[model samples]
Target: MDTHDLRLLANRIRRRDLQAVYEAGAGHIGGEMSVTDLLTALYFHTMKVDPAAPLDPNRDRLILSKGHTALALYVVLSEKGFLPKEEIATFLQHNSRLNGHPNRVKVPGVETNTGPLGHGLPVGVGMAKAAKLDGADWRTFVITGDGEMQEGSNWEAIMAAAHFGLDNLTLIIDHNRLQQGARLEDTNNLAPLPPKLAAFGWTVLEIDGHDMDQITAALSADNIASGKPTCIVAHTNKGHGISFMSDNVAWHHKVPNEAQYKQAMQELENAQ
Candidate 1:
């Protein structure tokens, strides 16, 4: 898809995510909106994924480490034809496969079950390593929330990926600078994130996470460094698109009321 179509798809995913969160009465909305564009770019413009044959060994793998935002992934996957759009209404409902966090066992496109802060990269490293061992060309992409970087496990995975020379691995940090209840700077600041990743013997790229062109360029084949893992520090805003919710910490997991939901829907519906 072109950049223009990608934006439209992203807003559609955002609208679906917003309605699901409002209907479910619980979600990490801020992070969901922040990461929607990244996910859209990956599945639509970057990854070699097939909904018809999701288990193909040669397919590109994506692990959403910041799994609290699974609603966004669900919407994107639904739009990509991995699941029926009607099933999205079942999000968070009792016995629904579309739970708060993605379940690989239940969800077709999900690579693994992820919700804990720092597991995805390690899993991604392992997948990349396996592909390398088999001389497979498939790549692994992992997305983590910035706050989740505080987990020590991620640092260990960072070391492992570099040590293994898994250039097939790509870690995209959704650096919105905000977490569940506070800003990352107020907690454990991982600012100057690029230098840190580069120092660890990984190739680092920085880009505006919400920009489709930048995202596609950074993830392009020519940009993947030879013999080194790549990490992208994607600068983004919490609650990215909605006016009142953008960068607001309270929207981290706050469900919108009736009026808030309507306004939010209108804004998403009219997003350029």
Candidate 2:
């Protein structure tokens, strides 16, 4: 898909995500909305994986480290035909495989079970190292929330990635600025993330997270350095497409009431 189609697909995923959250009565909707574009660009535009053969050893791997926003990935996976689309409606329901966070065992496309904040990047490092050991060309991609970056585990993995020269690894930080209860700046500001990662010997690329063209280009294989991992600081807005919710801290985990849901859905509809 070109940039135009990718945007359209992203909007559709947002609509589906909003509906799922509203129906489920709970989700990390703010983060989900913020990360939709990144997830879309990866599954649709960048990664090489066949839905029918999701576990193919040669296929690229993706880890949504900011696992609270698993609904967004679940929607994208459904759109990618990794699972039945209707199963999304069962999100957060009793015994639904589509839990709040991804389950690698239950979900076809999910590479790992992620929900704890700081686990994804380190695990991603392991996957990338395995590929290196096997002399495989496949890449590993990990997306983590900005707030989640405060975890010491991520920084440890960052150093390890650079130490091992894992060039095939790309860590995308969803720099949305908001966390569960307040702004990340107010809570534990890790602003200026790029320089810190660069200081650790990783090549860092910064871009507007919502822009599909920038996203796809940044994720391109050409951008990876020969002996250093890549880190993309994707500046994004929480609740990105909805007027009332965009960048609002309150929406971090709040469900939209009927009126809010309608308005949000309308905005997403017009967004396409």
How many residue pairs clash per model? 0, 0
Model 1: CA > 4 A from native: none
* Residue range 147-196, candidate 1, lDDT tens digits: 99999999999999999999999999999999888989999999989999
lDDT of 2 at 166: 100
Q: Tens-digit lDDT track for model 2 on 1-272? A: 89999999999999999999999999989999999999999999999999999989999999999998999999999999998999999999999998988999999999999998899999999999999999999999999999999999999999999999999999999999999898999999999899999999999999999999999999999998899999999999999999999999999989999999999999999878
* Best candidate according to lDDT: 2
Clashing pairs in 1: none
Task: List the candidates' TM-scores in order.
Answer: 0.99, 0.99
Task: Give all candidates' CA lDDT scores.
Answer: 0.94, 0.96
Q: Root-mean-square deviation of each candidate, in angstroms?
A: 0.7, 0.6
